[model samples]
Target: MDAFSEFIRGITRDNPILGLVLGLCPALAVTTSVENAIGMSVATAFVLVCSNVFISTLRKQIPSAVRLPIFIIIIATFVSIIRMVMEAYVPSMHAALGIFIPLIVVNCIIIGRAEAYASKNNVFFSFVDALGIAAGFLLVLVLIGGIREILGTGQIVAFGYTLLSLPINPAVTTMIMPPGAFLTIGIIMAVVNYQRAKKRAKGG
Candidate 1:
């Protein structure tokens, strides 16, 4: 429950995507490029952090019978704000993300945290939890996007900048397709599971 442990858990043990396997819709859809992954992650983080804090602050006043609706309302408000800001400043990415942006209102990670953590914790702890989970979300999305972009296009491009290019010619185009997302996530999950199993065997 300490801040540091909670934060680290989000990135490692409790990762929203890799660990908990939540929020896969956008994780698979907008992760074709690192830039899009970053954009979506940041937007989700904003909404999550804002809603977490707001819900935590009013937990005492919210009725249990109506908490779910209240959580959605709070989450939707922040989602709208971030959507407008992105549309105004980063129109291309905004369009790239498309329906997934509005769909953040229903993202399980955010809604789950609001009910399971934010509603039961103090504002500070809720904020910490949100930050941890958001960081984890960002990390996994970026990893998936980087792998896809590099394999699919043989290069990494972000916001008009080419970060890295591989010597491979005619990249595996399929890597950028839907199946590629599934393959990349599946491999990563397998590797993670293997590592965890190894640790368990050694009594760690």
Candidate 2:
């Protein structure tokens, strides 16, 4: 496939969350607020992109029997670097994200791409694929986070700014909980499925 098509496929047809259903743990865990969601997405993106490039570059040299271990090492190194950077610069976000930052090493999205795409593809396309998949992840996380934040707290606040607020507080704190994450993702999946079905019917 061409680079553009590959990139678009990651965002749409193969999205880790809304499409392929990968990486739900962090998706559901850190999306209570938009700020936390953004932080997680950025950290995950850094690891995904860096690991993809490194793995693709070393794919030929790495033995197939031990490729997975090498992939983990590469992923962990990037995750640790980002973790320390976040700790030093954005300590609050770093603390809020907590274990999830380190957990990115095992995130299916990263390992899956390393094995499935990066290991097989050239460096440039691997980079493109990571960017596309990361964008898709960010898209879903922010959508869920924004919905929960607005409904649960009657407003949306990120980076010390109120992007949205409702008159006469209508906060429903339940929307910030685990059940709310399930409900929000369920509704989103339904909508996505409906749209895809409609497009198929229209012969798109």
Candidate 3:
């Protein structure tokens, strides 16, 4: 039950994206398309999960003062691994993601999880926590990306396969711009907050 609670907490009560609002940089930057958002979220999830497990294993030995530096090194190493692999096998995704891929090293979501939860929990729990947070982040990214892609471009494609294409306009066009992303996220956040308030009022 404790483990389940931790999992739920990571997704909702303490979401790294929405609730805690940790990694807004990458969240807002790479979500121009669903594919880019998914790639970035997956890359960050890999690093977060691995770093959390490692940090938890070494928690006892890490000196309090040196822990931050050590954690950064560990996170950076994993980010490098992702970068190399993406460049080698998935060059297009690598190119599309751009600097944001390497920037995962500094993503607050990964670092915050490592310090706050992973460093203190067991390896298995750390994995669960990382998964929950990653899912929550991915959820937000997909929502933002989907809205932008459909409204802006009139089409939604993943890895070259078209999922849905609107017939109303061949090009709404504005959805691909920076302002579209901001507008979509703002409205979504507002709706989510309203729903939460409604649930609370009903004693949920």
Candidate 4:
């Protein structure tokens, strides 16, 4: 397979969040604003790329019987590193993310990629795949965050700077809440499915 095509596929065709439907918990939970979305994306991308490279490198020596255990350990190690780094440099985000940071250990996106792609691929391809998938995840989070933030707050702010300001007496508070997250996701899914159906009908 062409490496470039594979990388593009992860962003559009096989997006971990939008297409594959993996890693939805953080996508919904930490996407209240652009700031939170960026924070979560950075931590997740770090762990995903690190774990993919490491697992792919050792794929040959790792025995099948013990691969799952090995994968968990490897992924956990990276997750812990990300946790510490975020806590030290970005404590606010660290606290904001809460248990979800450590919970990355169980994130199916990480483990699933490790087993399904990393464990069988070369390091370079795995690295490329990780980058593409992580980028796709980040992009989706940012999009969702933007939508929710704008709808719920009537504005968008990042690092104390306002990116957008809308005139609304009272923003729809539900959009930033759990119900809002679900609603945004449901709408996006419906739109995506409709597009896919249309494409299939045209034999594309």
lDDT of each residue in 73-166, candidate 4, tens digit only:
9999999999998899989989988999999899899999998899999999999999999999999999999999999999999999999989
TM-score of each: 0.98, 0.96, 0.95, 0.97
- In model 1, what is the error at residue 16, expressed in angstroms? 0.4
* RMSD per model, one decimal: 0.9, 1.2, 1.4, 1.0
Clashing pairs in 4: none
Candidate 2 stretches with Cα past 4 Å from truth are: none
* Candidate 2 whole-model C-alpha lDDT, 0 to 1: 0.94
What is the per-residue lDDT of model 1 for residues 123-184, given as tens digits with 9 covering 90 to 100?
99999999999999999999999999999999999988999999878799999999999999
| Runs with alpha carbons beyond 4 Å of true place in candidate 3 | none
The model with the greater TM-score, 2 or 4, is 4
Residue 156: error of model 1 in Å? 0.4
By summed lDDT, which 10 consecutive residues of candidate 2 come out lowest? 165-174
Per residue, candidate 3 scores C-alpha lDDT tens digits across 1-204 of 477887788778787877887888787777888999899889988998889888988989999999999999999999999999999999999999899999999899898999888888888899889988988888888878888888887888988999898875667676778878778778887888998999999995
Model 1 is weakest, by summed lDDT over 10 consecutive residues, at 1-10
> How many clashes does each candidate structure show, in the order listed?
0, 0, 0, 0
Instruction: Report the Cα lDDT for residue 56, model 3.
Output: 89
CA lDDT of each prediction against the hidden true structure: 0.95, 0.94, 0.87, 0.93
lDDT of 1 at 166: 96
Evaluate residue 162 in candidate 3 and report its C-alpha lDDT on the 0 to 100 scale: 98
